[model samples]
Target chain A: GESVGLHLPTLSVQEGDNSIINCAYSNSASDYFIWYKQESGKGPQFIIDIRSNMDKRQGQRVTVLLNKTVKHLSLQIAATQPGDSAVYFCAEKDAGNMLTFGGGTRLMVKP
Target chain B: DAGITQSPRYKITETGRQVTLMCHQTWSHSYMFWYRQDLGHGLRLIYYSAAADITDKGEVPDGYVVSRSKTENFPLTLESATRSQTSVYFCASAVKETQYFGPGTRLLVL
Candidate 1:
């Protein structure tokens, strides 16, 4: 069975530093990928998304990098803040709009 | 404007009891999905509907049923609840590009 998985289950980073979270997907047929930030007690919020046709996409303070060759995806956050702490998940949309999500990574920011 | 909403933001029911979670969207999106979120399992799809009266099972669909008689409403029902069924359930709608998620309903079975 194809699955999307993350390399780190939890990450602790200091404020003002950059944080990088990695994810690996098993399905090559997946054409679209998205990154979501889930706050405590809330649903996942869309951060940014990148298509397989592109290698990278950047948003306000976040960036998503897709390495299709290695079947890898990564999310980068700049100048991490306390409010930036939350569980992050990566989702892949195949032929259908049904999204398969990866086990989230808990991002903890240290003051 | 109510983009997407779920009824009974929080629910507590007993085992063997039946509970239903309601989802409503105003976007008239063509795709709607139900997902469960738990520790270690980020978000597993339980069921999804491509259009009215068109439904299909997802990764985890056992012990659950869904009906989409209208494009704006997609409700998930638990025939007989169990402890293993306790988790936060989310309802989402996709407008062809990206999926928009509702707040979610937290269910607890004792």
Candidate 2:
């Protein structure tokens, strides 16, 4: 079975610093990857996504890097702020359009 | 009101009881999904509907049933709820490649 997993359960970063969250996936056939952010009680929000053909995709303050060789995915936040505190999840979509989600990493932005 | 919405944001029911969680999406998207989120498990798909009257089971479909009578609504029913079924349930609607989730419904079975 294919699985998506996070390397860290919790990551604490000081304000105005760069925060990186890593994810590893087992399905090499996965072509589409997405990054989601979930607040304390809100639903997961789309952050950024990268296709297997693209090595990196950038959003406003976030960048998603995908390494198909190692089946590794990462989300990088520049100038992390308190508002960026949330649980980040990485998901991979297969050919059937089914998405496998990771356990999620809790990001705490300390002031 | 424009995006996906789930009813009974919080529910508490006992074992052997039947409970239904309603999901409504105004976008008229063809893809709708139900998922459960637990402490250790991030989010496991329960069921999904591609269109009206077109439904399929997902990763964790046991003890759950779903119906799609209309394109805008997808409801998940627990015929006989169990303690293990207690978790935060989320409803999502997808476009081409992006999925938008609703504020989940927290269910607790005692």
Candidate 3:
């Protein structure tokens, strides 16, 4: 069984500032990790993903860092905006192709 | 391109009532998954289908049923709905390692 959890339940950030959301997983065999942004009244949308072999992967405005040693994962948003206000979730995929998601962290962007 | 879609974006049902949520994907992907999203639980897998006529139980499959008669459609059914089953249901299809999700169906069991 895999256990994915977020360090913070809610994160408040100022507009134009950077935001960081952290996640921890219990499974050491997890090889793939993904970040999803879920808006109110919508399903979780894919943000970014990083493989266990790589420590970091960058997207347009988001970056995902995976630390296998500590079983830690983090999503960093650059120049956060109001649109970035959403619940962010981290999920780890097992060898069987099943994904286990974390509790999620609500990101609030304050203007 | 309507990659994926779920029917009855919002549904309200009563306890012991039968309800079904429909999911369709245009990508023709081989894998389809059903998940329920609840507060403090993020998303939990309910059921998944590897291909047409091939289904498997996921993390949580109690009180739920799924069938894939065609590659383009997968429907989740609750034989007898319960309040605890009230949550946003999501459908996704995988392309290699990445999975693309549908808009989701919000189910409320009264």
Candidate 4:
């Protein structure tokens, strides 16, 4: 089965620095994409989402970029904080409204 | 009081035992979903219900059964529990576009 994957399993960055998480998806028909952040001992929390028609979308401190041609998605965090340390996953919505998630990337922020 | 909740925050059971996880949401969201999270992997959907009595299988729906008797409750039952079924289970409800997740239930099967 084709699945989404992360470019790196783990990422480390200094607090207050910028961080980027990359994901590659194999499904072409996917129309919706979402980014979720999961802390230890908790469920995944929605961060940001984008549709196929849009190329970029931004939230308070998070930005989601989508490239359908290359089947790539990325989440950029500005001024990464200590609370930002968590596992990040990129999920794509298939034709049947089912979401397929990537392996996830764990982010570590060092003070 | 208006968020999703999962009962039995933590549980341990022996293999071949039947265990059921309960999920409840205060919001009258029409869509409810069940997902399991494992180490080194993202959350995978087991089952989702569009409405009451309208349920469908998801990517990894084997060894699990789900029923939506009411709009706010979606329960997942493991008919024959296995060690491999040990994972953190999360329930989510979607009213519009984004889905809100619960705290999650941790199950350990020996």
Candidate 4 lDDT over residue span A1-111, tens digit each: 468889999999999999999999998988889999999998889999999999999999999999999999999999999999999988887776667889899999999
Q: List per-prediction Cα lDDT, in the order shown.
A: 0.94, 0.94, 0.93, 0.92
* TM-score of candidate 2 on Cα atoms, chains taken together: 0.98
List ranges where model 4 is wrong by over 4 Å: none
**Root-mean-square deviation of Cα positions for candidate 4 versus the true structure, in angstroms:** 1.4
Tens digits of per-residue lDDT for model 3, A1-111:
768999999999999999999999999989999999999988788899988899999999999999898999999999999999999989998898888889999999999
Model 3 RMSD to the real structure?
1.1
DockQ of predictions, in order shown? 0.73, 0.84, 0.76, 0.67
Q: Residue by residue across B1-110, what tens digits does model 3's lDDT show?
A: 99999999999999999999999999999999999988667688999999999999998999999999999999999999999999999999996667889999999999
Error of 1 at B27 (Å): 1.4
Among all candidates shown, the one with the greatest TM-score: 2
TM-score of each: 0.96, 0.98, 0.96, 0.94
Clash count per candidate: 0, 0, 0, 0
lDDT of 2 at A25: 97
> In the order shown, what is each candidate's alpha-carbon RMSD?
1.2, 0.9, 1.1, 1.4
Give the alpha carbon lDDT tens digit for every residue of A1-111 in model 2.
499999999999999999999999999989899999999999999899888889999999999999888889999999999999999999999897778999999999999
The docking category that best describes candidate 4 is: medium
Residue lDDT tens for model 2, B13-68: 99999999999999999999999999987899999988899999998999999999
